[model samples]
Target: MGDRKDVRPGVGAPAAEPGRVAYDHHWARDLHSSIRCSAAFLALLFAIDWGTGDLTWWRSALWLTLALLLFLVLCPPRVCAGEGWMASRALLRSRRVRTDLLVSVRTLDGVAQLLVLRDAVGGRVEIDPRVLVNNPDLWYRLDEDARKSAASGCLRSGTDTLRHFSERLERETALTVFRISGLDS
Candidate 1:
């Protein structure tokens, strides 16, 4: 498949009108705020101790603050929110759907998330296929496809309309399909 450009689905098909794709700023803001807040808090605590000339406070708070920062950095409140923005916009812009693909899978709260990148030029975007609709069978099917493709090493990723819609469908029906959260349509 890697040897053939036509291996991508809808290879010869005309591109569809682009969909309205936007990054979840709340997700990004939340991440940035968290990091900022953490750094501010640490600095404040350090100043408090230093000003008071309390070596004991510094020793205790330093370790505690460091530990908390470590935890925050390791497991940020929002998952891919940060990484998506971190991806290169220039690189993503050059990649059109069916021409270049992007895909990622991550498990959260025991639930596996299949994020299929739909567009990255304007901004990084990934649809959690599980969020589509409430069809457990379909979700399973997509999951199976991903797994099998991974196994065979023929997995292709893309940022385009088809991938966007597919992911949207999955996210919308996630709850109904998986008996989980009721998606916000």
Candidate 2:
């Protein structure tokens, strides 16, 4: 659907409580590796540029500016799923799609992989798959909504894509569970 409404799912979600899964108030997913790598790389550069000498204040300011800029540019989304829909809030905007009315689910591969969801009502959201992998509650909400959609004939297609996404998430979840149980092979 080409038409969409700027709507949020806060009121309709059960109890309007905080999300039980995939709720990242900060950068959405794990940024530890990225942050560490960036910081370490910057440190190395600073050290190389000013070895055994007092570093210039402007240079320190430059490093701080670089790190802050990197963080702001790479900031992730604020994703939450409600009773019937899911939303991914980015820096200045958010995207919400009705799961129960989902028309299709597909992935676009490029520099990054995005799982795209579309509804008959023209609502759409493109999110990172890791978002679902990290938050089971969001998956549950989407799965439940998709199930209801299928039953209602609102969602007549995209079963394959939906199943693929679901399976990937399930496999990851199982793997995490096994690892936690010390059952990794």
Error of 1 at 181 (Å): 22
Q: Mind giving the per-residue lDDT tens digits that candidate 2 earns over 81-105?
A: 8877888887768899988788878
Give candidate 1 misplaced runs (Cα > 4 Å). 1-13, 54-185
Clashing residue pairs in candidate 2 are: 1-122
Error of 2 at 48 (Å): 3.1
Residue-level lDDT of model 1, residues 56-173, one tens digit each, is 8558667567847654653322222221122212211422222122243322233555444332233233334433333343334444444444455444443243455466665655
List the lowest-lDDT window of 10 residues for candidate 2.
Answer: 20-29
Best by lDDT: 2
